[model samples]
Target: MFGPQVFLRLFVRINQDLWPWQVLAVVAAIGIPVLLFRQKRFERRLAVGLMAVAWAVSGYGFLVGYFGPINWPAVWFGWAFVAQGVLLAAAMFSGGVREAALPSGRFVALWLIVVCGLPWLAVAESGQWQALALFGIAPGTTAAAGALIVAVITGPWRWLYLPLLVLWSLFSAAMFWVLQAWWLLVAPMATLFLVGAGSWLSPRTAQSPD
Candidate 1:
């Protein structure tokens, strides 16, 4: 495994190379939850579509194309990200949004913090603005947001998407631990908490109906 400096350098390079694309990542990251929060069918479909694009772009574009040369394992993760994109595509077309619900206020607020704060966390940890880890372009933020996205929607099929996101959360948490980026752990830990609570609440919410 690479050391913290190498990891930081990789992130720096990625941020620099990706350039203005991070803006799109932010837009997609924010747009997804915003659309889902609306809880309308067409909006939900658009959210899922954007989510699928995010996963695919993050996986293939970042992991395989950019990070893979540095870390061979990331190539596998890249493919898995594409697979997740496929799963989301299936969910969107197969009527998975039918029972989607507004996330609890706590979920919404936590997600807001995660999505809004994560990119800058890289800057705080590395002391370099170029180390920004934007959502859709970075695995940590993407998986974190993906977990929360799955949590807000109701259905067993959504569980298909959770494992990879949680796996990436745990995996990235380890990487952050190795880097002594303790604050970065918040992204993964929050993802776990929100997803667990969302899973517990979603079924009950489905049965009860507001």
Candidate 2:
């Protein structure tokens, strides 16, 4: 369960006046690929659209306590948007929609270690155990669950991608909540870049044909 302090910190950070420039930058960064990438129109559209929706909801929640009255629903919807975005990106990169091969086992392993394992370790080392448990542990657990589900639905190698995408989305969300800095936009921005690049490099044609 999330702690009150964490929510308090997030509320304080987000409740500050919104910066129009920062919002524009985030939208632009997310929009570029949808405009440029024609090969994977469906995937790009889905990813960009979900990201836009999540960003708008988060921004609105920050501006007005739309959630303050019925907070759980807002939080649930917010995360649902993020989860959908993550899954859409995962499917795009993991050959669920198009012919995009999953990242290599070694690459996927390294990605998970850095994105998920390292963050958890860093939080624990810093003696922020509650934060670690809430943000690091819980997210890691859900990521593992997502990975398991992906593996069952796809394959073991495909499962590895979920942790990467989930961790990326979680870090992006945290940055937006804690810093209120536009630079935090880099997390998911980089994630989209990686997914597109990985798909290009390792085309899904390599997978065994059914």
Candidate 3:
């Protein structure tokens, strides 16, 4: 629960600290849906890879490097992110993830990707260049994207990471709570609940007739 200025500073400092990598983060986020929509064979892996980047960076870079200086709680948050990042990496080869969508929900998944990944940094405060909230650079934003991506993973353990992503969203909201950032909390929670519901209601892929 910090102030708006503080939130801005946190975001600005993080963006500054993660300069070049921030570009990579953007590319990765954009690349995911592109790959998925194109029906590329590597889309699932790409999604996981991007998620790994977001989790790892938000944990080690922001939580430790930036947020820790201001928030005492960030250290453990950092470790949590780091652990999740590790899990995401492991997920690639472990049969932990599969193609997104269960047939009827691909649209929803893509919608979430765009909403969470690339919204402008400071839509309300455009004059304040330093107050931007880019995806790869900000933990809350990154976690939002990560949660959405992991939510659709289709495997026996497809839902395995869902809880963690939800928890991360809550954790992000807590950070906003301290800062009284109602704007930030709304998106993540709404997305989390909506996606969870949609995924639950979505039809599974039909099997071919024998």
Candidate 4:
């Protein structure tokens, strides 16, 4: 396994290589929750599509193309992310998902926190803004935010999108613990909170937007 220093360095390289896309990713991340909050069918569908793009890009672009060289397991994770993207794409058309309305503000607030706060945690840990783990590009934020998004929605397939994200949350949390990057645990904690909230909310929810 790679050490913290190498892991941090890997992030720096990823940020540099991804360049302006990082800016776009953050921008899109900020907008996604707002779109969801609108509760309009078109905007909600757009948000899901964007979420799919985030997963697919981070999967192949970050995991397979970059992180895979150092961590072999990430290659398989990359493929899994790609599969998740496909699943989400299918989910956009799911009957319950497409027509559902977002009736709660709590989930949106949590989603906003994960999407907005996660990238800066990398900057805080590494003391380099270049190391920022933007939402759409970075696996940590992507999975964390994506999990929160899926948790609040109503659909038979809603559960399908969550396993990989939950696994990634646990996996990344373990990685952070190993590195003693204690602060970065926020990413995983946020994800776990979503799982908990979903457990509580999914049962009560009849049909709601993700």
| Candidate that scores best on lDDT | 4
Clashing pairs in 1: none
lDDT of each: 0.77, 0.39, 0.63, 0.78
Worst lDDT 10-window in candidate 1 = 201-210
Candidate 1 off by > 4 Å: 152-154, 200-210
Backbone clash pairs for candidate 4 read: 101-209
What are the models' TM-scores? Answer: 0.87, 0.32, 0.77, 0.87
**What ordering of candidates by TM-score runs from best to worst?**
4, 1, 3, 2
Tens-digit lDDT track of model 4 for 48-80: 888889999999988998889988988999999
Q: Candidate 3 lDDT, tens digit per residue, 97-124? A: 6554444356446545544533443434
- Candidate 1 lDDT over 56-77, as tens digits, reads 9889987898778878988999
**Cα lDDT tens digits for candidate 2, 1-210:** 343345334433432333333354345333433432345556544543433344344434431243334345445544654554455455555555433334345334434433444334323333443232121112222222232223222344444444555554565456445544333344454454445444444433346657
For every candidate, C-alpha RMSD to the true structure in Å: 2.7, 14.5, 3.6, 3.7
TM-score of 3: 0.77
Worst 10 residues of 2 by lDDT: 133-142
Candidate 4 stretches with Cα past 4 Å from truth are 96-98, 198-210
Task: Report the CA-based lDDT of candidate 2 relative to the real structure.
Answer: 0.39
